[model samples]
Target: MNYKDPSLPTAARVDDLVARMTLREKAGLLFHTIWFAPPPGAETAESMIDGRHMNHFNVLGGGSPREMAEWHNALQERAAATRLGIPVTFSTDPRHSFSSNPGASMMAGAFSQWPEPPGLAAIGSAELVRKFADIARREYVAVGIRVALHPQIDLVTEPRWSRANGTFGQDAELTSRLVRAYILGFQGERLGPGGVACMTKHFPGGGPQKDGEDPHFAHGREQVYPGGRFEHHLKPFEAAFDAGTSQIMPYYGMPVGTEHEEVGFGFNKGVITGLLRERYSFDGIVCTDWGLITDAFIMGQEMPARAWGVEHLTPAERMLKAIEAGVDQFGGEACPDLLVELVEDGRISTARLDESVRRVLREKFTLGLFDAPFVDPDAAEEVVGRADFARAGFEAQTASLTLLKNGPLPLADGARVYVEGVDADVAAGYGKVVATPEEADVAVVRLAAPYEHRPGAFEAFFHSGSLAFPAAEIDRITRLQATVPTVVDVYLERPAVFPEIAEGAVAVVADYGASDRALLDVLFGRAEPQGRLPYELPRSMAAVEASPSDVPGGTADPLYPFGHGLTS
Candidate 1:
């Protein structure tokens, strides 16, 4: 009960809470389970928050800001009434973007819509990065989200990696700079009341996957370091440590041909304990990536447990290995019963249990959750996605447009224009709209670069596999260009092999994520394209295949090297 006292230090409060907890309550602290948004009028939040005795959650989908704030307060109320009265902390993947992968990040629903992390990297202003983080922190705190599972500092060394959208680009120094700003933005000078703690992720870096495959599936489980650049990947994390991030999350990919054990980082004692805990001296919480201990169905599709090299181990064995590897919590999984069983059976020592529970409780205390767990729902309605905040996000989206070619840019006003992949109504405002490329003075086309499509709705969201455009799509671009001057824009989530698009399009522009108006603003000279290439755009898929995964700019001759951009 003394833990509730505001005057006590966080350490003293953590000690009080840990000493009072039973083995079951301590076990529950080690799990941060997933919770999808239920339909309106559904009665599920209470069961998961109180009935299951879960205190940490990774929120998947959510409704309006006011609704989410109310729901969170309701959950906290239920938790407050429970014995020991631990407050629930909610975490979420990056949400202020166009991408809507429920597993990776959510869509920009009622929140200020900023371009993803790469867009921030493109803008290349530490001040802007910090401001974005602060705004995100304010919106998150208003709605009861206390932890951010983002600012993925992984270098975009392997251009084909599906998760590059969440990175600060391929340069270690640039990523490190942004990482410092991001941490400061979320956690502030110190983490306490009003601070939204940042969980800097994929420790030692998650990039450099073999053939750029993600570790979410069996095919993408291996992370190779052929260029002998293992230490190079840790630079941003070192910066993260300096910035005082609240937590670290290791990747799921198993290392191949490295000095570390050839298991997933979540279970690699040498990587987690030796590199992170000992060498880096990161004493904060270490949570495993989602779904390492058990299989779960997502979006009506069955997914195998992402245990990687340790698939042969049982669930209990997996938990033991993760603990021994120095993990404090498990993401996307809740197995307090299994943890209870392990301690009761004498397989895991209670001393080991105390170690993790202390770290978890310390965070709760530091967050001031024990003193003030609830938020004002009325204030949340006013704070979330205010007009000023949304304008800044829109401005950043416009600023991030990367101009590859400016062949007669700022096309003369009142010229006849034909457009595709852009709103025709918006295009009409700039010039007279034409039906075909032949009937226009200039043509505009927008396309997302191609990838070898994967099955399943969940799998499809991750645009992995090959980075090349198909022949037909490439030919179509060339034919349209022959008829008239064509301005083409490609949404570059991954580095696309587009030598043909580069040569054929009279004007080419690249964007991470932008609105129809934002893209047009850049084309018409209304907004400056302030982004540089985050990663190398390889000359061909052959060059990408030949390059080493771990090495940045490994291709012999990239069409566009890192930091390449043009001004109109």
Candidate 2:
């Protein structure tokens, strides 16, 4: 396969392929995986095994589009049977929409189903979030996905945080101008050939947590900044490192009592080498925040205990404290032979594995993947599911519909509407869709609460040290919002109070996923809600058990706060 010389300079062809690799090919270029297992007696053995052994790290998920081009041609035939053939970047996580993580669910069966990220920041279009990240980078590089763990700009000020529907709501100047127009529409005007890279994630901000839970187990591993406003979560990660983002992951909470570093921010070296590589000069690739070096298990159970303030350190001491807290990589299913047993026990340093294998081979040589590392599985059926990308995911689910209250919302067009709790064919296209709510002139409920992954009880359901909700489904939506003029809505990927269906509705919308014709085009006014409350709405679980589990503000209050939202 004729080599080198493609007019050098992707950091000198990744430092001359890291001076011709070896150290298990530079620890298999710092581990990453996404699919490809089928070997031991083939025929998809429980979807290509995971009993752990020949493991790499990252491993992409969220299928279809000919199963992501047959799992990227079986992850490039297992990186051409590793041994320096390299090629296997892959990555992914936000497979284009409706996020609630079934390992990055992407199936509206062929991508392009936007409106989630608080409905693209309630449709305050940065050119429609860069045309939905350029049609999700042309359906993820037509099915080989070169790297985009996602645009999780994180700053929906914590409402019981179950991945606040992949944030972009609670304004920081409109999430710093739509996270720099979604990293210039998924790394285009650069980052080598046909772009993708982009990894912009959890970094210095993973919303305040603590009371908003989620640190992926261990009671949502603390991150309170109180009114210290935690440096306003590092201003949209310094506007996503001045909109160049080639990589950065950082989360796994633990900013306890702030001023940074109480451990976890991938073992904080004052937050990744004192605030993202020496005061934001970035220099790409940071990673780490997927099973932060072990002791985490889901669906197989065993997690619980980390409200920050480190304690259970083992996964080879969190992989030598995340490579002396600089971390170049190590995500999900970790075990790059514990980074080749901490570089054969001298405890890391082969010039720190050649500076994280030269920033993971300069992001696989700025993602040209050495000039195309395979893709055409029949042009993934003409660019994976393109009905104008589901009509631009139903016009970003009708401009992220919000409408908090409109008295008797635009109902009058042939009204006999009573549509409660969705699905009578998504509420018979908005009118005369009765199915009892005491049958009649306007009720329409449509709620959503379905993510019960107990995984043998993830420390009694991911913490604010004990979140709740499910009193017989909030007493069956407070007995169908006491019979009539209802219009509830909810679907808030996390954050629960419901205060008896918000003091018995006449209006209450909230969203993060909508598409029953964008919930009946914001229930009849034909789309005008402009979604807002991207996290705060507490108003009782006794104001979330009288606040302060380590800051989430006091007096709880909230029946909506983080950028409120409502505009007829």
Stretch of 10 with least lDDT, candidate 1? 38-47
User: Which residue pairs of candidate 1 clash?
Assistant: none
Best by lDDT: 1
Give TM per candidate.
0.98, 0.38
User: lDDT of each model, Cα atoms only?
Assistant: 0.88, 0.68
How many residue pairs of model 1 clash at the backbone? 0
Model 1 — TM-score against the truth?
0.98
Can you tell me which runs of candidate 1 are displaced by over 4 Å?
A: 39-47
Error of model 2, residue 455, in angstroms:
38
Residue pairs with backbone overlap in model 2: 33-59, 34-59, 34-60, 218-305, 403-529
